[model samples]
Target: MQVIDPVTLDNCADEPIHIPGSIQPHGALLAFDLEGILLGWSANVAQLLQLTPTLNTPLAALALPAEVSQAASECLDSVEDGEAPVTALEVTFGAVRFDCIVHAYHARLIIEFERRDTPSDAVAAFALKAHAAIDRLRRQKSIDALLQLATEQVRAITGFDRVMAYRFHQDDSGDVTAEARRDDLEPYLHRRYPASDIPAQARRLYTINTLRLIADIHYTPSPLVGRAGDVPLDLSHSVLRSVSPIHIEYLQNMGVGASMSVSIVVAGRLWGLLACHHMAPLQVPYSVRMAADVMAQVLASLVQSMEARANALLVEQSAEVRTRLMETLLHQDEPARALLAHAPGVCQSLQAEALIVTEYGKLVVHGDIDPELAARMVASLPAHGQDMVERSAVGDWPEALRPALAPWAGLLALRFDPATDGWLLALRREQIHTIRWAGRPDKVIRTGPMGPRLTPRGSFDEWRQMVRERAVPWAAAERLAASQLLGEMHRASVAKHVETDRARAQLLAMLGHDLRGPLHSINMAATVLQHGGAASTMSTRIQASSTRMERLISQVLDMSRINGGLGLGLTRGPVDLVPLLHDLLDEARTAHPELRIDASMPAALVAEVDGDRLVQVVSNLVSNARHHGDHGEPIELMLDERDGKVLLEVRNTAPAIPAGLLPTLYSPLKHASVGNVRNRGGLGLGLHIAQEIVQQHGGEIVYRYAASQVVFAVTLPRA
Candidate 1:
């Protein structure tokens, strides 16, 4: 057969066209023209179902799947009907996906086979043809068509069951805005999934990687990382570790055998999920998966481009929410509690509840402090209990920090600004309880086991983890303002802490100077009474007063050292606790013999602490109880061993720390209960001094109020 080359650059992309390798060994060519003409034979024989140039030459036929043939015929019909000469059709051949574009000019059809792969190269070509389509959209100025065209492009290139652009809702759940898939996947057309379905651990990993593929739930899972030959190994570029096992189990439990997902981002924010599923184990070739990824990118870009205007609307809508919150915070008449009661909507706007505002230890604005779950968590970490705190397991946080907040069940600390001497904390249900992702067809980029390939996966945990890295969705106009607010809050908190500490040091310095003179005078008086003609009873009373003055001086001095940044010193060595406690107890009782004392410690208990500082810590606590808890009750000092640490606790029953004075005890500044009916007077530095001394010995002293009784506990590392 003499013939000029029919394949050209027009027949394929940049590369040379790959003609279906020679169909016949004898070289009697069988080729069709765009006009459906078999040039080797007369045109009259072209309509024959099976024909050969020579009657003796038997026709060899290739069996094509029914879907492919029908798709080809439809494309040809469109051409004959005076439509485009070549029309693209999406079709399935067994488990494989294909893109078939049919051509008809003569009496014969020339169907081109472009596998659902090389979507990047394919997009380059389509962008050229679809430039007009894109222009149509630009003219229409309609986001719907923009999304629709992008979806069709992805479907044509991926051949997945169903592809969708699912948007995240105010709740964790999402809605499907665009859908493109095989007709068989009608169930996922506009479906939704609960955010609870995707756990927190899974969300955090999504931002680092792309491409979530669950070939089959029944498929044995190999280690996501590490070398295992014959497993398509690529440690540096693997996608398994990026995927979460928990989510894989979730998909398996959900009866989904296979799943693949990608993320769609709009304006640098995670917009939605592009999800795919298969009923059985599915293994897509790298080339095919990559093609889908490229196609998804184009779709995501188009959608994002079209939604640029709508983003402005979203920003405007949030104005009301922001104003309400600002109003609540700035309200002059209403306290934070009243604000919460009258403007619940405002609190929700900040995604917080239980906001607390304090100037030093005094509560100026407080909505909810003792949140049911937050209380338990606070108790567990007493050292952190006093700070303006919030925690959440849903909405946006990492998985590593979940266990610490589990007891709180999504109670989160809002950004707190001490500059205003106020805090914004939240105690609310987790955001995951409200929102979910259906699927996002536009996102072709993600980070994970897939190594920045795609998102949406069989492992729900892995998928959610990736989502955690999602950027905040505040619009550009709002972002600057939001950042300013967050910064202001942080700066305020730090400024307040500094001011409180500075004032506290000044008071202690003055007290240290003033009290020393009187303290020395009292000691001289006591000494004279002891040896003078004065009675022994008079000597004891004088000595007691002298000791009280000494204690007040020591409290003042400890505060000065801590405030001056002297910090703690280390003298690491084994030290016996029994002798330590007994000696300190003797000195304490000598100062106030009338106060009862009890000590419990193991005979051989020892720890690593500064001996002199430890002594001071114990003595200070005893002295504090002697003065504060003057109810004539025995003060209990409990020492026990737990978790390899020696615990020393001082217990006393007395008037509570005047409620409002609780926090200022540690604050450098002295805080008095504003209008407490109970008359209590003290600089509130006893516990602060004791805490510093204990810490210098590498220990911690904590105080807890139990109704009328206040317990001060100190723990040191056991050696």
Candidate 2:
């Protein structure tokens, strides 16, 4: 009933599993130097090969089979350092034949002789079986199907009693996802095993060596007899490397006499394992194990493909949701409010239960989340440079917030604006579920001949536990989607800021130049009246200045309303264009005596329209032409009907607008600077307001520049 000490359990991770100092009893190992002199041999090599071993003896003097000697020489010549063992040749000793596996390690040529149990002709059969298995696996459309097929194929190829596909989780624990076994054997599918079952060092070796076998768990380990000062031989890549005693005891407790594992590596990481177990001692031939290894690799590749495809589909869906959210942000005056309105959809896309949006330290939550708890969670999150932070376990959160966050164990926080502390957090409620572990997942310390050592648990009966205070793990696709949404939010924020700055600069410009002119004229007229100058002349000047100031104020108000998502307040009525045009021309002529204006129109042309709003449109267009047009050329106005629609065209001779500025030509507060001819005494809202008024009347306004002439045409549908 002794429990392992915490320190000793931590020390287990540093075990020298690679240099085990021995080989399994199924094989005999021999180590030689470059000069063909024997350096080390396993203790049972004399009994296995019937050849007495001698230290510092030349290999040729051992009187071994001629083929074995030649094959060992060729292997030493061709094998590179640190390479995995290669099957060099097959030779017979007395009546039994063995396969020679050779590799070079640390200036020594090591060879392992494993008994050849399968007939030589079985090699071709194994090759054909592998090809068929891979073809069948390729036909599977999902990871589950592929895993099931893989386990079945490995069992079929190796004749093991049980084969299970054990997939590793983010926590390093594993679950048996798929299984193929004899009818009398108990099922292990969906059973979980703790990370401590496979220590860190053993997992590292799994990545280095793709296949490992324990032919007989009860067999004695043949100790290597090397020179007095030599270090323990590194069996990291050895096929016959002895199994760890802890692992051996664990397998024995499970009633497994033999076991083999093929590593499933994806993108250079150990993704899972193809674990095979037999009820009795089983020696699988090297050729057959190679076939199983190939299948395992194929399974890894297929799993990767299936996962990538699913993730891609999720990303596409998330992008659609993001596009809709962006539209809301751009159209509404308050972006945070708009986002909160669509919180449910966002949460669904992110696979979360609730959403929290924070702007300038104010929190707005959608769903059944408490505002106080949400605030605490946000405050407790450490400031990170990354735009997105994801946490699934309660312990992963800051200690101060863990107690409050217990109910909501998962968090995906996207920081859209670091300056304003704006964040969009998606939360998942704690999901309490039961796990069926193969055992209690605890080990004990036992004092044996090797001193105090950590031993595997003796019992492997099914054990169930209820796990709480943890949420279901988030998928990679969800994180990717969150990151993408963060990027879009950042871009939208920058655009909003740019527009704000531009409007601010325009407002200052108008206040300094446009309004000051009228103010100065009114002031001068008032002073003259006060000093007893001609009252009629001073009154006329004051009236003109006051009218100009009123027009500027009206234009500013109109722009503000349109920008606030409010359309123009238009009153519809029928109005004749001929008189309106004539009267407008008379005023323009009187106002600018040095300018020439020309007009053409059909008599009595009229339509359903907002008369006052139409007047503003026409007046703005004429004033824009006068200010920006070439002064030497006559301004032309035409009123006519075309294609059953009323067409009003205002033409002026001016240089074409710059290409870069054309896109923003009708945007509020954006004006063109053409060769120092500034927009004299007017805000840049004329065209934008004109477009809005025309559209409100079910018409469209278009601008064209051709042959040094700028034309703005309003097309109104005839009622």
Candidate 3:
């Protein structure tokens, strides 16, 4: 006896189970290239087929039965057309008949021959049974009903002791959702199995192969014989492929003599399995297995259809909720408050117990949950690169926070605005339950022929485990609905902001127009008093105040126009900026005598521009610096040319703007504070208007801060 290496949990997943270089003893395998030269053959082929297979010799020369030769030719034609394997041919070898299945893989044609014990007319009977089973499955209304019926029908067809409808969870673990078994046998329904029982590679193979059968778990394997230099054949698509040793041991430990699995695939993914087990060695006919495979396919299709219908219903319900939320948002001034007010509808739509909306560092929760605990949970959530975070178990949370959040086991969080740490969270309270498992999932390390390693448990008794601190899982449709709700909320919030901005602009326009007439009267009165022997100081002061008021009104009107989408009107001409800068600096000195200003520029630089608009830009920049800059430091203004473009830079010594506020700095009506003091007597539209004017001139303006110096640089084409 050969001493094979022991299988351990660490290396079991890596075991190359697909290419076992052998076949089950019940069947014989032959491999030949497209040119008909034999490449490999199972050791049992001579006994099963009554002919010896010679390496590198034409299969025709070996004198296979005429029926097999003809079937092989037809199968090759179908394989060339990209069709699946063919298994319709049966040939008589002496007195016994054999079923021949053929497929093409890795540039080789593989033929499998298995003894046929069924009647010659079994195919017609299977066809009728399959049609009736499919009709019954299609008539079922619900997925549960369909799956239950499917298990029963598969059990009746295969005559297995037990038939289970096993569902794979998102974590790859399995649950026997439905079952059909002999009345005397213990039930395996509602039992859970750990994911390690089916390794990743096995799951992948299941997806590709659709059906697998082990006729007799106690039977020996017939090894394949090939040339010395040839590699192990890829038996991924071979029907007679040998079983993995570890899997055989697993089934033996369970006292299962025969087993088969029919994959339930949906949308090209392995959704679940129809697992059949027999206590005695059983050999199911090929026709019967094919019938079970058809039923599973029908079940997969029906499951897909039912799930789609359910998801569509969820989508419609969520759409209605979103519409109602939008209407409320339109009527109310605060979006977050309106959403919270309608939280019940939103929560029900998403199947959540509570809804929490976090906006601008404020939490508005609407449900039976503690606000402080919700805040802590929100703070502890790690950033997941903009992906939605869904959890159903307390253990899925951070270890330190798990104990605190033990009472709440489900969390679905969507970050709506990452800039403001805005998030929408849904929570569900924990529900404790008990799970029945086939056995204790923990494998035991036992001494084997090779060494001590992990082995399947010997006991087949039921094991009950108490599960706590977990909630019912969120369904796929629920996740989709939550994502849609978040997106719609964002859109509604943006629309609300636009509506508010427009309303503010209209109000400003009206206020600025009304103030202009009064200012004109004040200016006229100041002019008359100065010339009519009044105190020149008083008249001058009145005139200066009126002039300042008029400029403020002009700024107000400009902001209104910009916010209203009517941009500033400009008159273009060539203007000398050197004198303009000097006059602006002189005016600034007269306005603030205590503040120092530094200037650097060319003697005379001419550019085509709206001189008044350009001055407004320069003045606003200077004023903004004075208001926000450190009073103890000097403000520097520089004008120069670079790379055939005119450059204007205004630098002020001050701390850089907060990173959080920088993104919305130039938004209209936004105010920033410097050392806890708000901007000095302005509508907070200086930078916004400046940027608008610069962009209209086909130029760009950018803000940069370094070493406590804030710089606003404007680059304009020299033309």
Q: Compared with the true structure, what per-residue lDDT tens digits does model 2 show for residues 445-513?
A: 877886677888787788999998888888767877888889999988877777767776767776567
Answer with 2 or 3, whichever has the higher TM-score.
Answer: 2
Q: How close is candidate 1 to the true structure, as a TM-score?
A: 0.37
When summed lDDT is taken over every stretch of 10 residues in candidate 1, the lowest stretch is: 19-28
| 424-451: candidate 3 lDDT, tens digit per residue | 8889989888878788878887777856
What's the CA error at residue 656 for candidate 3, in Å? 52
Cα lDDT tens digits for candidate 1, 100-170: 54544334344433334334466465445444444444454565555565556555544556666666664
The best-first sequence of candidates by TM-score reads 2, 3, 1
Regions more than 4 Å wrong, model 3: 1-10, 80-84, 228-230, 381-387, 398-400, 447-452, 497-719
Off by over 4 Å in 2: 1-8, 34-36, 58-62, 80-85, 122-127, 315-353, 361-376, 383-386, 398-407, 484-488, 495-499, 532-719
Top candidate by TM-score: 2
Ranking by lDDT: 2, 3, 1
RMSD of 2: 9.9
Report the number of the highest-lDDT candidate: 2
Query: In model 2, what lDDT does residue 499 have?
Result: 71
